[model samples]
Target: MNTFTETTNTASTWGLYEQMRPQEIEAIQEKTPIAYLPWGAIEYHGNHNPTGLDSIKAFNLCKDLAEKNGGLVFPVVNLAANLIKSYPGVNFPKHSIEFSENLIRLVCEEYLEQLVAQGFKIVVLLSGHAGEPHLTILKTVAEEFNNKYPDKRFWALAEFDILPNDLLVANHSAIGETSLQLFYAPETVDLETLPKDRLITLELDAVSGDDPRLATIALGEQIVTSFVKNGSIIIEELKQKYL
Candidate 1:
């Protein structure tokens, strides 16, 4: 009876490891040996969305999935690789808080090692940060960890990778990401702050793709629903294979 509708209730306190009591965690562990680790970054997402948008989105999605499918939801890692060197309108001193690729890889490896040591057989790493370098590093770390720990399973993926191609169209603070923020973290987005006169360019702003002005909460909800449904299926499959 774990339907999509049942899982979309964001108010549910079933998935978050930080929110659950020790006994409750023990009970969940008895049922499933899978864990969800959400990784995000504190990078600029234009004027409308918060810097923590990536992490927030990933954390919420992981929570939704863990609620439907049995698993432990680890706290989101907010620091990620932000490859915004060439992008304009970037306030490096103020907003850009990033870790090196090697450091990130090491962190991921350690996290996996600890999770496996804690008795989790399968660890699903969902990165909210869409930077190619970040994703590549994560994938490499996951591969190396799996090689070292043959008994444990590690799966790393970016958030967009799980979505359909149509919904997959996203960019820095564009319609896709804006809509998602509107749906998941409404308070963090400020559409009013966006310039209304001229079209935002990569130099003027880090925004790309379709205008975010066209974004709507309805569209965001649809995307989230689809992502959760698809993600739940993937998690179930992983469980069957590894746990």
Candidate 2:
């Protein structure tokens, strides 16, 4: 169903990181030596969109990027995001279930270190959730890694960070993300779940930004194209700069 995702990195049994064998990883690394880590949360999206939208969107986008640019997509980081720090004590689920900023930093730091240990020359952290606090943490950790590992390259960003300003319409449970899924994984989106002829809002439907009803696969494709293009450039740059 996901035509774009189904392609690329699927060459002769070599697949994403999860399905790759030792020899496959070494072979791919010999060619690209790049690793991609996609992250998002299991938090609510809305009545129509699945809750895994964030992570799924990121993962699918990563697959597209790897297909175009050549790399291995690490497994999705589903438990990475946390509640907005501004709402300190107010959490949808128990605080224990949601890791804190410190824990998040540790996880990212460890992941980066392990990727490097696995012989990856370049590492990318891609997020779909775009939660302010989580993004901030990821960016900080990336900078630290870049400084500490002069021999390797590290980059961290949400899907929109590299996009041209005009295409930066990313948001939660809205047109931007929904359209992305429509293009990347249409089977996961259920627009009919929302009431007929009713306005969608953040409070009532967990929808934000312009109405998700406006999302289209064409628009999603445009966004995906931009992401892959810009991301490829970044990887090339890292190779030149660090490798």
Candidate 3:
């Protein structure tokens, strides 16, 4: 038996076993101890999106996933792996890829160790910020952790990976991520304040995508639906094959 729970009341659900009453915790412990970690970064998206976009995306997506798969959901990790970009006056030059990667690895290892100590064996590191270097570093660290532990597992996904490779393109605050955030946290988005021109790949280069002004709650719902549907398939496959 593992210590975990399946609940949709996000505001009331216990994020960690430590946060729950002893009885509740024991009940979950008798069930499943697996957990879902939402890894996100605090970085600039653009003039429109929130700096906590990555965290927000991860949190919401994890919530959806946790509801479907019974497990504890750790709070969003706001500071993820990223680099600093010095824009004259628009944004601060806060690149911290190396630093962030080290910190992310340390924090994740510490957290996973703590959970293991508490009798949990599974911890998933789902990264919402899809920076190539960030993802690379994250995967490397996660693999090393798994190799060292051997009895535990770490995993990640940004939802886009489920799509066919040729059908996808490198998009930052464009159709992919923006659509996800829009679908997950529409209230946080304010299209009325958006630039007349679309901002493309806010991370690497100054590129724009389709006018985000046209982004609607409906589109957001569709994205979430797709993610949940595909994520369910993936989870089931992994569980049957690995767990």
Candidate 4:
């Protein structure tokens, strides 16, 4: 595909005007004022994966979509919700995770409000972290935001929703997330440092749900391709319906 880099709000060349700083943005805004925002947390992924796995995944996805469509990626927001604390054997939360969910929801709500105030008519919330409460709160906030600000028309969409199960759940590293990173950001990975012991494998499965050692760049590319196609389709449909 042809990749063209346009100046975005986050880019040094463009200021707060964001997708509208350039003449193209003004023209497109009148036609399709769409923006994609990624939300993820800063917590442990596994011994093999980096702690910024969620943020990295989210940022890369936004970058891909933004490259195709005209939009800007907000800086990553790292707030742990479900994966609050860790134990020796388990990389996930060890205690009850209730308080953090509310905190995360409020923070997200504020950010969403700011985005709307800044003139983003169509916003998408793409999250990599599967923390149930954090995700749940995000959904609630999206609903409330749309209801309160009908003109803005904001929506929260999961990356997996735009991908097929074969792409989302068939590979290593929680199925698709690991593969995507492998394809897009290989330097973030270290296969030599990966644990190979049988005991370690079983222990990791008990906590993180999938085996990270099995992740590959090829699998990640498949997932990324599927996401780009489906995500663009959804964005186009929303644009036709709303914008």
Query: Which candidate leads the pack in TM-score?
Result: 1
lDDT of all predictions: 0.78, 0.77, 0.61, 0.64
Residues 66-163, candidate 3, lDDT per residue (tens digit)?
Answer: 66655677777765655335333334464323245677777767776676687655666777777766777667767776787776666666656665
Give each model's clash number: 0, 0, 15, 1
Over 8-120, each residue of candidate 4 has an lDDT whose tens digit, in order, gives 33421211234344675555445446666777666655555566777778777776776665556666667757663533455455322334777888888888888776677
Q: Give residue 36's error in model 4 in angstroms.
A: 1.8
lDDT of 2 by residue, 193-238 (tens): 8766777866666666878888889888888888887887887688
lDDT minimum window of 10 residues, candidate 4: 7-16
Query: Could you give the candidate ranking by lDDT, starting with the highest?
Result: 1, 2, 4, 3
Tell me the tens digit of each residue's lDDT in model 1 across 108-214: 88888889878888888988887867888898889888898887778898777878778866477888888888988787888988889999766566777778888
RMSD of each: 3.6, 3.3, 5.8, 5.3
Global local distance difference test of model 3:
0.61
Which prediction has the highest lDDT against the true structure? 1
Q: What's the TM-score of each model vs. the native?
A: 0.89, 0.88, 0.76, 0.78
Candidate 2 least-lDDT 10 residues: 88-97
| Candidate 3 Cα errors over 4 Å, as ranges | 1-19, 84-99, 164-170, 197-211, 241-243
